[model samples]
Target: MSLPTPLTAEAEDSAGRRTDVLVTVLAFTGIAVALVQTLIIPIIPHLPEYLHASASDAAWALTATLLCGAVATPVMGRLGDMYGKRRMLLVGVAMLVVGSVICALSESLAPMIVGRALQGLAHGVIPLGVSILRDEVPAARLPVSTAVMLGSLGVGGALGLPGSAMIADAFDWHILFWTSAALGALALLLVMLFVPESKARPGGRVDIPGAVGMGISLICLLFVVSKGADWGWSSGTTLGVLAVALIVLPFWGWFELRTPQPMVDLRASAHPQILFTHLAGVAFGFSLFALNLVLPQVLQLPKITGYGLGESLATAGLAMAPQGMVMMAVAPLSARVTKTRGPKTTLMIGAVTVGVGYLLIMVLMSATWTLILASCVVAMGVGFGYAALPTLVMSSVPASQTAAANSLNTLMRSIGTTTSSALAGVLLAHMTIDFHGVELPSENGLRAVLALGVGAAALALAVASFIPRHRPDAAVTPADAIAEKVGLRPAADAD
Candidate 1:
């Protein structure tokens, strides 16, 4: 075969600039989307007062986001694959901006839940961005680029805690959502200016029936997990939702199995490599979110409780800020590891590190510095695992299906996080001690949660260990090969 023509110097420089702009914009977009998850966390305890609602009702602010995100992620991914990734990405970002504005103006629970749910719809941006990178980035640079994108999730979440806490302390809480709106607007502008629409349109009809079925099942499952404690585990509402989830799952499976262009493509997902990766995603999700739940509470609780640090919200946030930095710093290194040892090995290493971090928290919880140290350790592991999970997922699936596949992986992690929150809530609630007329979480309660985190980490490692070893190269679509051959990508990365 004849060799392809080389790009001219100016053309090559232009391609480099475009690639740089694309990666940066998409990574920022991911971070922008992620910030929504943590923005309300600082104000959760006070939500009842602000919204003129009962504690049980105020909790729906968090649950709304989780439920909406769980349902939206996979659907958006499939839509991106069918329509255009860039188009669907823009829609997600726009929803975030709109959601934030509604939240900023809200004075009651109803609007706040609506705003938060809209924000949750944007969760698809990160995975969609991953799929975009798979379609657009040069094969040689894919690992490190993908690592940075995945790392953005940790960075955004890590920074959001401290940042939102400080804002809540200093200003009206409305400012929190306003800030998110501004960030979302910025991400939207950057995407419009720099990010190009992907050319890999695996055009097909959307599985609307499948989407509806899956959405209903996810809503039921997440509703039961998030509200079961408040509704009473044995209550009719909880049991009814749980029963609906169980009942719908089998039917959903049956429908998806029969559909020609199913939303999830269950047949491909059944492969040992993909199946195990998704399971590992759930384990790591539980592992990561458990730290988020435990650290802030342990740091902010009254010192009279003996195990509490009694720090201000802002201080606790500042202490944990290092974790996000550590996550960003370690992500490139994880990419390097993926290049040398494989993504599976990198993930296993992350699991062990996370478990060690939780172990440290158990043994050393008296000082803020120790919490910082332990959390940073956990962040390092998160950086490694988060970066690797998507890599493993994208590598195993067809390029055209990358968005849907990655979204499903993300959904698994969401399931893990929601489950972690529920279990932690239950443990902390019943395991409380009476402190001067108020019930406070006992030391053992906190330890039990930490122990759960350690167990989650170990579970992640075990699940990752079962991932079938494979070559690192991702399957390229014919369009990708054509684009690369025509000098649309950088030759420098080919080194």
Candidate 2:
């Protein structure tokens, strides 16, 4: 089978004798960063006791990381586009290393949460890796390399959960963070040794105000989504935060539109295809997290609940592990679909598959095997859908804006996931079923959460229908085509 190459030979050839090895190392480094993000999940169940935290407070271990990543990703992307990907990547790696080490050595949850926040900056690696493809690899290798790098976003987290579970079960929870620290160290070494400095934006100035505005807006928005359930969704705190987000987001948009070298070029995101991609990213990200968060609760419930399988943390992780592996396996095929039918078609297919997967889960709520099957379907759909998204975004935007553009895409996905987490929490809290007067499904409250996922996937399908399709051999490059649709000047020709 011939692989689609997106990079020119001159680009790949410039790396000399170590190009292949370097690419492999960088890919793994990207994977390690992904692993760190999720490696704590299996241990979440143990955190309350280990850290002497109340159940609600313990959730912050994950929430803090999510909040930090949501704020940092787009900012890092803009910095990478403005300054250098390698520089931002190295900074991210350093943060991850420090965070992991602190978490590994911490005696309390406060320090651990602090560490996780620092590690959140590492989420920038995935987009930076994708942007690197535009700068490095030979044109012939760009498609597959791009697919693999982006696919790692899902694959890394999926694989990390099971591995974390096994490690925690065999050793102790601290070992998981320590192992993550080691992975961070290795990633730093690989990045320093292999990834080349990008020439895309050698001397651009950082847009400090633009970055601060965007960051504050995102933090406010994500804070509402992440903590609204705990703070009372209608409480003054939550409503006030949402209002601030509403006020800041428009100003941030206006700021980006007016800045000569904005942190993120808002004009670039106005394209029909790009806009649809961001909207789809929200739905897709919601589906991914909904499944990840709910399935384990369902599987680990007491068997007396009638619907529960009573699995251990390790068993639950193993059950959901196939989704990640399937996603990895399907990503290359998704790339082919994009190459042949275009991104719009691929996205539609993914949306339909995702909806079908959720429908399957809803139908099989009474069976354990159904959970696994539904996960497989969802993973396959997400792999295809997720792979096509960055391709669509990158193809639509200029190479110069790859990092920032992709980061915005990533940020949208995070927003989706954050909203899903809050929404699912509220829905689960309200939808308790009285099972033999015992309320068996009330512990983790997941069935309602999965139902919300099904709804989100359906919305994704609706959004996918509006994404514009293009022919494979069309005269317009992906970025140009999107630029034209959005009425923006092409980046290559834009001053």
Per-model RMSD to reference: 2.5, 5.9
Q: Which candidate is the best by lDDT?
A: 1
Q: Candidate 2, residues 306-350: lDDT per residue as tens digits? A: 667788877887787788778778867887877777777777788
Candidate 2: stretches off by over 4 Å? 1-23, 138-140, 434-448, 473-495
Cα lDDT, all candidates: 0.88, 0.78
As for model 1, its CA RMSD to the true structure in angstroms is 2.5
Worst 10 residues of 1 by lDDT: 1-10
TM per candidate = 0.95, 0.88
Tell how far residue 483 is off in model 2, in angstroms. 26
User: What's model 1's lDDT at 278?
Assistant: 96
TM-score of 2: 0.88
